[model samples]
Target: MAVGFAVLLTVGCGQGPQAQFSVRDTTEELLSPAQKAVKKALDDGFGTPHELVAWQRLPVNYGGVHGAVGEVLADGKGITAKWEGDAAGVTAGAPLLWISGARAAESTSVDSVGSFDAKTKTLTWSGAAEPAPAAGDKLVIGFGQTLKTGRMVYMKNCMHCHGVAGDGAGPTAKYLNPLPRDYRSGVFKFTSTLTPEKPTRDDLTRVVKYGIPGTYMPSFLWLGGKETESVVEYVRWLSMRGEFEKRLDDDLSGDFSQKAIEESAEKALAEFKAAKADEKPEKPRSAGDLKKEAVAKFTNETDGYEKTEFPGVIDDTANFLAQGWTHGEDPESLILPSVPRVPDDAASRERGRRMYLSDKGKCYTCHGIQGRGDGAATEDFWKKPGSDEVYERRGLHDAWGHPLMPRNLTLGQYRGGRRPLDVFRRIYAGIKGTPMPGFGRTALKDEEIWDVVNFVMSLQYQSAPAPAKPAEHVAESK
Candidate 1:
């Protein structure tokens, strides 16, 4: 009977750990109260990884013209807005949404709006706006400052691995082999775009829809176009948030700490309580009054500290964050080879093979001599960034501390793309967030890189070598 009960209990528990325990969510718990308040304000006004909030509407001004709603329309995957005044400064791929109230708090209700469609001047939404926006409601448009439809999609699909803050330190992050990407640096690897620039929206969308081949990031091919777009927007949003936090930390870390804020709050609460106790019986303070007084004190203390130390940090950080993303979308930042790709003939392949083996190229250091991805470097353990410790296992590792393997070119599987330009970009710009280094313009000229690109492309179609036979024994002729 005892054995049967134990068996039943084990069966009921299942093969894996039961999902009945509670884990504390430490996402924002480490933040100071003042920082938490700022994050809360951003959450309330511009949504978070967990919820969708309305965009904080701004009054429009175009050239001499000011405060115009402009004609806005929605489409399947994008939105378009046209106005009489100068819309020249309005950036492409910016976030835009309409809200009814004059202020963020008052603009509690909002439509499920998607991102702007710069090409067609249309605004797209997953569904039709409810109780359609009224005339008085203002249309807000900008980058890095709005709540978007993508926030919801990202929270559902990516928050577990990427974190609510997009720091790639989500609850499941510690368990993964390769750490998820931390977008705070606003840098992405495996882009077809140029160096020092963020990936294009299309590039990001492609990565989300089609997961990296050798990595744990699963493809979300099932998500329709609109849903994928939303996730992209949310990712950009989180990246901006992380950048802002980094900037703030740089400017304020010396002056502030969470302990200080907690102490301030505690002191304020105690003072409020004492003041309330001193009040006459007929003029007692309400619970609301004490709470309000405490909050005001906390805010004032923090505000004073900020003003005295970093007066321009807020505006500077916002502008810097916005510009960082905007510059990536600029046309001039793209890298196009000065010369066309060399023909994929045997000569070009041989030239590429030579470069791959040369010390200047150093391709064999990580990728084996035969392009088998079995290089000697894989035997050594790698160190994690910002830490004194090295990883436990031996292998190549990306910037995120995940074990990485040099691509086995013989497999002909390309994670980025198979196009000529795609291969060219990989050789030129190098894969970001990984050990790959860009060799274009600086180390190798455009033509040399193209030769390498041609060789890499040919690896897929080439036939694999047959296995070598072992030496036969004489077998004593029995």
Candidate 2:
């Protein structure tokens, strides 16, 4: 059957070139001018969907660059530096980095300075310096604010399902079983990293390159490293934009309603007419003029409100988003099972089976007795997150509001990964944005988890033979 299915797919399917691109607006039209200003500021500081923002990391003490820094040379024109160890990897037109306190008068481009010399192992920058670097102050080379190479790559590959805004609301998004990720929340489901931490670049890259199994996301393994990096950058950019929008909405939703704008415009118009009535020759005001005046008033109000309340909100939001991404890179966030995996033997499998059916583990409640993914939960109604109302249909639902089904382990297909550690992490961390709960140190013992892992791994094969019924024993008197 499997062979026949593979042949059918091979004969029936053929890949095609991607469709043409079209630009889409990402902003909500209802936003007031003040709200728009805040969003624009965020876009200008960060890059927009169409443009890439150029930025350099401060020194290690001043927030290190994306990559490492090497030795520096103070020349007559400006400063020149060599790439750390692997000098050949450095590309022309890359962004240059300087210590926080010491930087160039203007942002310097790699080509503007001079071509990198491989033999001499150095790049020469003859530009003028603002505050020159002190001796031993570290300098680094980088790719500054330039167009992101990944934007086009992502548009061509991901926009259909993931959407232009990375909100998982693309034209095809509604058709998929598990809806595509909404990067706006800055949260990802599968990660070796722990909770509250966003996936690292490598984590995002791996998923994009390899693709998730048993899902609509296809592998992009054909893409080269540069292309892959570009997609990662674009995805991160979208995530930042989404997060900024969310923060702005939270801050402005109270005072900037549409009704308030209309009411304010009417009041301004009435005041204008009343003042004009006193004039010897009354001048009439148009609706457009009234709207303009109202908008100006609204802007002033927003500015004042922001000055008093926005600073802390912006700071808190920025820290929350930045920390979420950075935490994934921390080593402490990884989940390492305390005990090694239990052996895939009969005894271990039986122990795991016993636990799976037990009331405490309750795996059977959702996964079913035969591991066929036909548990009663599939027939039951569930509530949507952040809302009290129940879903229209009966079944499990992910954070995205799509109907979700438990994995049928009998198929031997693991979407996260096939490795033991990969499965273990899924059990340990619980797939984020889904109903799966992590049963690590708190809920279950280390040994028991390993047993469950072993049993789950064994599910691909037939269930272990049931133990023989023992004969009833009878005591005899002599």
Candidate 3:
């Protein structure tokens, strides 16, 4: 085995390197003024990956103080504050985040404070806060450090393919056959969780540590425990942020899309033309007027959303994310065989072979008659999700819309894991974000699934594989 290290350094002679996260693929030209405003709002609230904003409403534990201001110093240094939480562990140079008032969305380091004073609270900083911290001005200190650490870890190790935003559109992403997993959608393929549930931290940990087999995602078991934890937290945070952006865009796009603005302009033009033709001295409305009216309407309508509804959306999205991840680790969400596996002998394998060829299992449809993965399903067109329209390409497609080929069992490679239990779970829970359907309690019995598992395990071992004879076959073969 060979190891490769990538050392990326900005080659500026005097200046240090600076990095910033890339925005989503939505281009500026496609957005109206209203859409641009929404994007700005999102940027301010969430911030770039480099300078992260620790939004208190999210599930991320940014780690900080929610302190209130006591008094602003006469001299342009710092202010006194009543810390809401304990500041015992904080050192002289710890970060002091400004949460509200004039200094909101700003942070400064603690220059000097001498000693902790319970009676007379004071904090001196390196720079003067322009509009000094007024009385009861809210601030949080030592915030976003975890996210920062996670970002560093992700950048050094995972960024080549995962991308800074976790959109899976990294520099090397396009060359890979099975495209990198896009965490923005919050869907993982090989999760232990039951259907519709997000992956647990353990699921992510397993994937990171062991890597997905038969794929470019190599193992990173050498990563330290703290590094692993930090990366997981970072991935989750990125996923949440991306999901939030997507949901927000969905809500805003109807009114703020360029099409909407164009439609509005067309309507206004028609009305103006009709009035002019009626011989009334109506002022002719130009395209600019229609746009201004659209922008004004958008501002008026979205003001409520920005002030009231947007916050609720944030809270709801966070709650939804939290619930999915939390419940994934629950015992009930896991898939386990009800009984022990049937012995891996001839009779079991034979039964499994029959089942594989039968209508009940129908594994041959995708895996092919000889388990070569060149099944007829790969030649047929599949419908896009939630629509009657079919995909442009001919083949099975995953949730990511990439043309997918079913696993070739004869190759003896299982992306999930080669372990018996892992394959069992794949069959039981189904591979999330893929066309592989689960055959758990709903479809196949535990013994039947085990038989199928045994048969699948036997496929690679045979010198020349073939289906069972005519009378032995219980059902029609695919």
Q: How many residue pairs clash in each candidate?
A: 10, 4, 1
Assess every candidate by TM-score.
Answer: 0.62, 0.74, 0.73
Q: Give candidate 1's root-mean-square deviation (CA, Å).
A: 16.8
lDDT of 3 at 3: 12
Residue 340, model 3: lDDT of 95
Write down the RMSD of all candidates, one decimal each.
Answer: 16.8, 12.3, 9.4
Output the number of the lDDT-best candidate.
3
lDDT of each: 0.59, 0.62, 0.72
Q: Identify the superior model by TM-score, candidate 1 or candidate 3.
A: 3
Candidate 1's TM-score = 0.62
The reply for model 1, stretches above 4 Å from the true place, is 1-148, 169-179, 254-304, 381-393, 461-478
For lDDT, candidate 2 versus 3, the one ahead is: 3
Model 3 worst lDDT window (10 residues) = 1-10
Candidate 3 lDDT over residue span 1-478, tens digit each: 0111111111222222235555554424224654566566556556765456655555565545557878877785666778777876445656655556665533332222333455567776545446566788766566565566667778888888988788888889999979988888888888877897877778888989999889999898999986887788788878877776666666666655666657766886677767756675556566566566656665565464455565576557666766776777788888778999999999998888887777777788888888889777999999999999999999899888898899999989988878888888888888888898888887789999999999999999987897554334653442
Candidate topping TM-score: 2
Candidate 2 lDDT at 465 equals: 32
Candidate 1, 311-427: lDDT as tens digits: 456556666665666777777677788887788788997777667766667776677766778777888887777787888989877765667888898887778876789878888
* Preferred candidate (lDDT higher): 1 or 3: 3
Query: How far in Å is the alpha carbon of 195 misplaced in model 2?
Result: 2.0
